[model samples]
Target: MPVAIRLADWDTDRDAIRSIREAVFVQEQQVPVDLEWDDQEETSQHFLAYRETTPVATGRLTQGGKIGRMAVQKSSRGCGIGARLLQAICERAKEQNFQQVHLHAQQHAEGFYLQAGFEVEGDVFYEAGIPHIKMVRSLI
Candidate 1:
């Protein structure tokens, strides 16, 4: 599959990012509105992945490289979209001089996060009614 990652300021990527987030988090996972939508959005860099000009995945990176709102369209889950989006996120963080990147890993996704070089450093907790754990990766 062909995919390209673009880096843009908040204005350029907001809609695409929100669409994917709503598709995956809201429609698919049922993450509550209060949690799925957050105040941090304005301060994040949204990365939208398009396959042949169609948005297939999206994610966001915060100032300190906190990655969240990572999502792959339902039909695209097993096609490496998430991994590629994550790779883009990490590369963006490195380019921005971030020393570390962190994520709230839904417990079931620990293995996926692990494959991306994230390590769990804390107990599992609840977030938006889903069990999650704090995972971090260092680039420095």
Candidate 2:
């Protein structure tokens, strides 16, 4: 079965979204405490997914069409939830008048992002202790 998803509203979702991120990027991935949490989250349209009331994934999108902080719970990996969450975010971007989308994908996820139609645009760089590359796709 496809994973269940829930759209996040910052005012109502900050807790769930933060829990998901803290689990994947901080607790599991060991990303530094300071870097994994950021100020931009307040302004971004964050999406948090729950599987039967358990937070399983989360991501954020900016009004300018950039996607970031996508995380799938370690236990939920291989469920295709990440792709679905991304698709939903892209649709949301279009509904909001965005013409393109951008994300800094972890080096390991470049292929996953590629499968989702994103093309790597620049050299790899380090972010949150992981190697990453910028990826972009047009909404059209």
Candidate 3:
């Protein structure tokens, strides 16, 4: 099924976005609650992927040239929901005239961002006890 992706309101869509992230990041991946809900949500531009009004995925782009907090419901994996979320966030970065977009991709998710045109950079590091690598994509 096709998913509808749109810019999310920080206040209005916060709960739905948080629910999806909490499921994938906190519950599934074991990322800590403190680390998952970093106070940046209010500062970043968030996007949500919905299937007939049910929120299925989410991602966010920061004005500081970073993309983070990406998550898709466990039941919605392998259905292109994550890609849709990433694409929406990248489009928003382009609209904001950013020349490049960067994200600290979890090691397991490196291939996903690579397929989306991001190139791995730097050595691996740990964030919230999970290994991560920096990845970047040119929006030009």
Candidate 4:
């Protein structure tokens, strides 16, 4: 199914964004609740992907040009929802004049970011008890 992706307003879309992140990160991945949320919500540009009317995926681009908090519902994986979301986020970054965008991807998902034109930048590190690697994609 084709998913609809759009830039989300944090105040209006907070519930849907929180639901998807809590489901994928806190529940499934066992990431601590404290680590899953941050003050960035108010400042970052958020992206949400929906299947019809149901929210299926989410991601965000921060004011500092960092991409993070990406999550796709378990039932919606491999459906290209993530790629579309990333594209939308990247386009937004370019529109905002960001030189490059970077993300700390979960190790297993490194290949996903790689396929989206991101290159691994450093050694593995732990975040929220999960191994992750830094990846960057130039918007120039």
Q: Which parts of model 3 are misplaced by more than 4 Å?
A: none
Question: What TM-score does structure 2 among the candidates reach?
Answer: 0.93
Every model's Cα RMSD, please?
Answer: 1.2, 1.3, 0.9, 0.7
| TM match of model 1 to true structure | 0.94
- The digit string of per-residue lDDT tens for model 1 on 2-73 reads 887776557776778778888889888998777887788888888888898888888889876799888889
Score candidate 1 by lDDT: 0.86
Residue-wise lDDT of candidate 3 within 1-140, one digit each (tens)? 77899999999998998899889989988988988887788898988999888999888898797999888888889988898789889888998999999999999999999999999999999999999999999999
Candidates in descending TM-score order = 4, 3, 1, 2
- In candidate 3, where is summed lDDT lowest over 10 consecutive residues? 32-41
Estimate the TM-score of every prediction: 0.94, 0.93, 0.96, 0.98
**Candidate number with greatest TM-score:** 4
Provide the lowest-lDDT 10-residue window in model 4. Answer: 1-10
Residue 75 in model 2: lDDT: 86
**Model 2: colliding residue pairs:** none
- Give me the displacement of residue 110 in model 3, in angstroms: 1.1
Look at candidate 1 and tell me the lDDT of residue 53: 86
Better of 1 and 2 by lDDT: 2
Cα distance off (Å), candidate 3, residue 36: 1.2
